[model samples]
Target: MIIVHDRKDVRHEFDVPEGKALMLQLRPKKIGIIGLCNGNAACGTCHVYVEKEWLDRLPDPDEYEAEMLDEVAERRENSRLACQIEYRADLDGLEMTVAHRS
Candidate 1:
């Protein structure tokens, strides 16, 4: 399951396919909130803040994602590019906020 804290409202999705990128999974449900780069790490629009406790559970951002993160004005210790994350069974309870675009 993926839980998103958006617009002061909480949303959840439980049927995400494993190995699908997080950005792709969020597209239909989240609409304009993320994935402006079409799942590529080209844009900073898909930035998100991973819950602190789940930070270590996720892999470190790749070079492309890292570059994008650095470009995001909202970048924080827990920030990540949704396009870089692959939904997996281990990430069932993952939670994050859709970051404001910079």
Candidate 2:
């Protein structure tokens, strides 16, 4: 179960199957992520702030994702592109908030 919060602070919870990335899991759910670049990490539309407890649990973003993240107006120490994170069983309870666009 991945828990997510929207810009309006609406809480959302859903099961994320393994093998698919986080963005793919989010888009179809209409959870408020834009994913404008379709998981390519080229746009910052899929930006999210990982929950503090789960921040260290996810893998570090690659250079490309890092660059995209830098472009997000709401970037923070916990910010990450959903496209860069793949689902894993260990991430069952991961939590994040969709980043607000500028």
Candidate 3:
């Protein structure tokens, strides 16, 4: 269960299956998260900031995702592309803030 804090400050709890991408988990719920490239790691629409403690727990973004993230002005040290994050049991309590893209 990842607790996603949307840009509006609303908390959305989701049961993310192991091995699934975080973007897929949020899209069905219509939680204001949109992956314009459909999880291809080609778009920054699914940008989110993982809480500091959980940031290191996730895998580092790949070169493609890293390049895409650079396009987002709101990107931060803990910023990540949701489509690049795979779900895992240990990530149950993970919390992230949906980035407010212009």
Candidate 4:
């Protein structure tokens, strides 16, 4: 399961399979994630914040994602695009906060 919080403080939880992209998980949940580039890594609209405690559980960002993160507002050490994160069983209870708006 993954927990996500919106700016309004609304939260949602969803089950995700290991090796699946976070973006795919959000889709079925009707979460308003803006993947403007359609997972092509060409836009930063999918930006989100990985909970501090779970930051280390994610793989390092690829060059494309790293470059895009530079353009995200308020980019932080834990910021990442949902498309770039592949779910893993170890991340069963991952928590993140969706960017208010991309």
Candidate 5:
């Protein structure tokens, strides 16, 4: 189960199958997350702030993803493009807050 905290303070919980992209899981829910690049890592529309505790657990963002993160508002140590984040069995119960667009 991945727990998403939207900008409106609403908590959305859903089952994230292993190997699925986080963006794919979110886009259909209409919770305001957008994967503008269709999970190609070309845009920051799916930006999200991972919980501080889980930050270290995720792999470091690649160069392309890092560059994209810079274009988003509220970029932080935990900031990441959701499209680049994949679901894994170890990531069960992962919690993240969707970043608001500027």
Candidate 6:
């Protein structure tokens, strides 16, 4: 999967196998993702925005993901955390935008 930053045009790729958490894929790349609480859904620092085209491909966010996103400075319908999202083979080409907090 690859993540593209809208403003900077930066792109990151992960060699993720199915069933791995999206956050795990990002860690090895040192992509500046802040997975505070270690995937427990307690922090908003890991927020990212799924590209509109890829939104439906992802599972709906759970209650915790929703709550944490709400705390994000600029939450949007596509907003989610790298930690909260899991990867599947179908998401091999998935793209998302990293959302930075103020």
| Regions of candidate 2 where Cα sits further than 4 Å from its true position | none
lDDT of 3: 0.88
- Please give each candidate's TM-score: 0.89, 0.95, 0.95, 0.90, 0.96, 0.88
1-102 in candidate 6: lDDT tens per residue? 565574365876656777767776675565666677788878876788888899888889899888888788888888988897888878778888878668
Which ten-residue region of model 2 has the weakest summed lDDT?
A: 27-36
Q: Please give the lDDT score at residue 88 for candidate 6.
A: 82
Candidate 6 colliding pairs: none
Candidate 4 residue pairs in clash (backbone atoms < 3 Å): none
List pairs with backbone clashes in candidate 3. none
Per-candidate clashes come to: 0, 0, 0, 0, 0, 0
Model 1 stretches with alpha carbons more than 4 Å out: none
Instruction: Give a tens-digit lDDT track for model 1, residues 8-79.
Output: 556664568899888887877854456777978888777888899999889998888888888887689999
Q: Give residue 96's error in model 6 in angstroms.
A: 0.7
Q: What value does the lDDT take at residue 77 in candidate 2?
A: 94
Q: How far is candidate 6 from the true structure (C-alpha RMSD, Å)?
A: 1.7
Worst lDDT run of 10 residues, candidate 1, spans 6-15
What is the Cα-based lDDT of residue 21 in candidate 3?
88
What lDDT, from 0 to 1, does candidate 1 have?
0.81
Q: In candidate 4, what residue range of length 10 has the lowest lDDT sum?
A: 24-33
Better of 1 and 5 by lDDT: 5
Candidate 4 lDDT at 38 equals 77
RMSD of each: 1.6, 0.8, 0.9, 1.4, 0.8, 1.7
- The TM-score measured for candidate 1 stands at 0.89
Comparing 1 and 2 on lDDT, the stronger one: 2
Please report how far candidate 1 places residue 12 from its true position, in Å: 3.3
**Top model number, lDDT:** 5
